[model samples]
Structures are given as structure tokens and as C-alpha cells.
Target: MDKENYTAWDSAEFLTDDDIIIEYLKAALEENDPAFFMKAIGNVARSKGMSTIAQETHLGRPSLYKALSGERDPRIGTVMKVLAALGIQLTIAPRQA
Candidate 1:
């Protein structure tokens, strides 16, 4: 395939619907990788407009990006704030045995 024939793929472009976003996050959670989960959250946030999420979460855009870059372990409070801004709620369930 010619390089010019293909456009880069971005998950954020397809995360427009709330249901889809929820499912995407759920899949990320199933990965059992904290970094992956954070990246997933970042994708959802970008889909919703990072500026808006920043305002809602009272966090700077740069800080938000760094926290969600999947390179650092963000605090639970920070994760909670980001999730809340994305209109998502974290719930607990018993692990399957």
C-alpha cells in the first residue's frame, strides 16, 4: 500500500458515543495494565475535547496529557477527577474465580 493511500488511525475518532466509550474503557480494564487503562482514558478524553475535560477537571492541559500519557502512575484522586470529567463512574465488582 502506498503511504499516501492510508491515513493514520486514531481511536479517539471512533469514541464519539457514550456506550462505545464505556465499552472501550471496559476492554482496557480487562487488559490488567494500568498504563493501558490510562491511555484509554486519554483517548476518550481527547474524543470529548481535551479543553473541555481540563476545565471540568480543573487540571491544566499539559498536566492532563502527562498524567494520561501511560508513562507515569497517576494518583487515584487524579484518575477519579479525570473519570468524573469524562462522565464515567468507577464501580467495584467481585473478581471472577
Candidate 2:
């Protein structure tokens, strides 16, 4: 197998539309891991351009990167800002028992 023959797979490349981003996020949320969700958000942000997201959120690029890096727990306010910048909204629904 020639490694150069195949390009690496990046989920960010496939997150090209709102519907896809929503579904991707839903799957990440189902992982039941905050870190995973944060990383997923990072992927979406990268797909949409991190610089744009940072500007929209009024956050510095480095700050945004650190927050969404999945190595640190970001504040809820920061998370909300990032989601808004990404044109994503969080909703509440009754969980299936």
C-alpha cells in the first residue's frame, strides 16, 4: 500500500452544509463526551474558516483555538459564542427514556 496514493480523510471537508453539520454535531453529542463535542465544534469551525469564526465571536484566533482544542474545558459562554458564530443553535428536548 502506497501511503501517498491515498489522501487523509478530514471530516471538516465533508461538513460543507448546514444539514451535514447538524447531523455531525448530533453524532458527536451522542458520544456523551464534552471533549468530543468540543473537538467536533473545532472541526466545524475549521471547515467554515477559523478566522471568520473568531472575528464573529469577538475572540482572538489563538483564544478560539485554545478553547476548542479539546484539551481544556471551555466556559459555557465561550461555547455559546462559538456555536453562534458557526450559525448553530442548541435546543432542548425530552430525552428518550
Candidate 3:
């Protein structure tokens, strides 16, 4: 494939809408891997504006970027803070047998 023939896409661009972001997060949660959440949250942070999210969560921008990076695991508290900042609340649903 020719490099010029392909266009690059960023996941964050697809998360421009609130409903889409929520759905994306739900899908990520369903993946059942801890790293997926970090990657999803990182994509969200990028979509929502890292500086804004950082300010809302009272976390440093650079640290937030580092924590949400897929290679590292962020604390549950940090994840909660990010979710809260994004106006998302986690709810438990009983698994179907």
C-alpha cells in the first residue's frame, strides 16, 4: 500500500459526541481487560481535551496522559476521577446465566 493512499485516523475524533463516548466506554468495559479501560480513557481524554479533563479532575495534565497510557495501569481512584470528570457513572448489572 502506498503511504499517500492511506489516511490516518485517530480514535478520539470518533468520540466527539457524548453518546458515542458512553457507548465506546461501555464496549471497552465489556472487553474484560484492564488495559482496554486505560486505552479507552486515554482516547476519551484526548477527545474531551486533556487540559480540561485535567482541570476537572484536579490532576496534572502530563500525569493524566501518562496514567491513561495503555502501557501502565492507573489506580482505581484515578479511573474514577476521570470517569466522574467525563460525567460517566459506573453501574453494575447482573450477569445473565
Candidate 4:
């Protein structure tokens, strides 16, 4: 069966708030998948305007696009810079094992 048309899903459309972004990223990170983390970051970036984040991070818009494109593995330093640009800080805590 062929469907006429379907709208593509965009996580960014649903991730609009900063707090939500933080929680979403945290949960996604818990999965321990780099791709998921990258996608989550990309969603927040889209919500916040990639250009604005790029400027704040001193990164080129195209580079940001590629880094957060959900395919490439972004360097930890790059991720930290992006988080800082978003006015968020990353913290480490022991996971209950």
C-alpha cells in the first residue's frame, strides 16, 4: 500500500524549551549511543538557531551543521563548546551500578 504523503518527524519542532532540551539530552545520553547524543544535541541546536550557537561557539555554521548532522561523531571538545554556547555545562556523576 502506498501512502499519499506523510510529514517528516523533526525532534527540533518538539524540543522548544531549554530545560526540556537539557533533560532530553541527558536521557538520550543515558542510552550511551553517540549517534543518539548527537541527534539530541542537533535538536537543541535547531531549537536555538544554529547560526546563533555557531557564532557563540566561534564555529562556522557549516561546521556546526556537519558536526551535529547526526552522522558524524563530534569531538568531545566540540560538544563542550556547543554546550557552553547554549549556556549549559556538562557534569559527571557516578552512575548507580
Candidate 5:
């Protein structure tokens, strides 16, 4: 099945554990630390399936693997591409700390 064919259930009528988890990860990525951002995204990619996510971002599976595996730091454009593909939005706000 194509990953793009799958839709995230944000609706109250059909929320799944995965949906909640994804939301948490998305929220956590809002932290000030870049490491937190990377880890959150990596975790989500693993749960969502790397190959499917790669296809969604139009990035190659090998490239996604390298980025998420921490072997390399993805460029800002790459990070934005993956986040957008995963339906994650990053927002800036005042630091809680």
C-alpha cells in the first residue's frame, strides 16, 4: 500500500494510539533543542515506516535512513521537507524556560 494513500485520523470519531503518539512527538519537537527536534522526527519516521515516509517526502529511502539514523545532519530544506510530508508543523513561540 502506498504511504500517501494512508491518512492520519485527527477526527474525534476515529483517533488511534498512533495518532496520539504522533501528536505528542509533534509537540515535543517544538522544544528549543535541535536534538529534540531530530529525535522526535526520527521516532515518528520509524513508527510511520521509513520507506513510506521517504516516498512521501520524495526523498530516497537510503537518504532518509542516514538522516534519521543520526549518521548525518539533514539540511534545513530536507528537514522541512520531511516534516511537511509527515504532516508536522513547526511553530515558534516564547521559550518556557
Candidate 6:
């Protein structure tokens, strides 16, 4: 099935609070769930505007889809590039209980 055929809610609801979204994303990273990470990336991309992100990262739309959707394993640098393109700043925090 095409990814575009699904809505954001299909995987997770759209997180309205940016801070909460970031925190949830941080926790997901800590858990190391590739699917969760991909979902977070997709949510961020959807919230931030995929086309604009693609343009800013100098990546084609299909490339963005593959990377963010986990169809391909992108390098850490590439993931950072995409996050930067989406105007999101990543920060590390001590593991939480």
C-alpha cells in the first residue's frame, strides 16, 4: 500500500505541543524502536512540511520518503540534515526513569 494513502493518525495522532512531541521523540530514541523513530520522523515531516524539508535538504521527495519511512537506513548525518531542514533542534538528555 502507498504511504500517502494513510493518514497521520494511522500510526499516531498529530502531536500539537511541540515540546511534548520532542520529548516523546526523545524517549522513543532511548527505547531504540526503529518503527517508533520512523513514525516520529514522519510526524515531524508532516508537521513541518515535507516539500519544504525536501527542498531545504536538497533531497528528492522519494528519497525523503525512503529515509523517513525506514525503507532505507540513512546515516546519522543524513538524519540530522533532515531534522535541521525541518527547523527542529535535537538535544540529548540523561536517560529518564
Candidate whose lDDT is highest: 1
CA error at residue 74 for candidate 1, angstroms: 0.9
Give the C-alpha lDDT of model 6: 0.74
Given candidate 2, what's the lDDT at residue 31?
A: 95
Model 5 weakest 10-residue run by lDDT:
9-18
Candidate 2 vs. true structure, TM-score: 0.90
Candidate 2: give the clashing pairs: none
Model 4 root-mean-square deviation:
1.7
Task: Give candidate 6 regions above 4 Å deviation.
Answer: 1-13, 92-97
Candidate achieving higher lDDT, 1 or 6 = 1
Q: Is candidate 1 or candidate 3 better by lDDT?
A: 1
Q: Estimate TM-scores for all models.
A: 0.93, 0.90, 0.89, 0.89, 0.64, 0.70
**lDDT, residue 19, candidate 4:** 78
Predicted candidate 6: what Cα RMSD to the true structure? 5.8
lDDT for position 31 in model 6: 73
lDDT by residue (1-97, candidate 5, tens digit) is 6556666753322323666766766566667566666766766776667788888889998888778654567798888888787776667878677
Which 10 consecutive positions of candidate 1 have the poorest summed lDDT? 1-10
Instruction: Say what the RMSD of model 2 is.
Output: 1.7
Q: What is the Å distance of residue 31 in model 2 from its true position?
A: 0.6
* Model 4 Cα lDDT, one tens digit per residue, 1-97: 9879989998889887877888898898999988878878887988899999999999999999899887998899999999898888888888879
Residues 1-97 of candidate 3 have per-residue lDDT tens digits of 6556666888998899999999998899889888888999899989999999999999999999999988888899999999999888998889757
User: Weakest 10 consecutive residues, lDDT, candidate 3?
Assistant: 1-10
> Would you list the C-alpha lDDT of every candidate in the order shown?
0.95, 0.93, 0.91, 0.88, 0.70, 0.74
Q: Give a tens-digit lDDT track for model 6, residues 1-97.
A: 6556644444235566677668767777777887668667876776777788889889887878777885567778778888887667777778668
Better of 4 and 5 by TM-score: 4
How far does residue 17 in candidate 3 sit from its true spot (Å)? 1.1
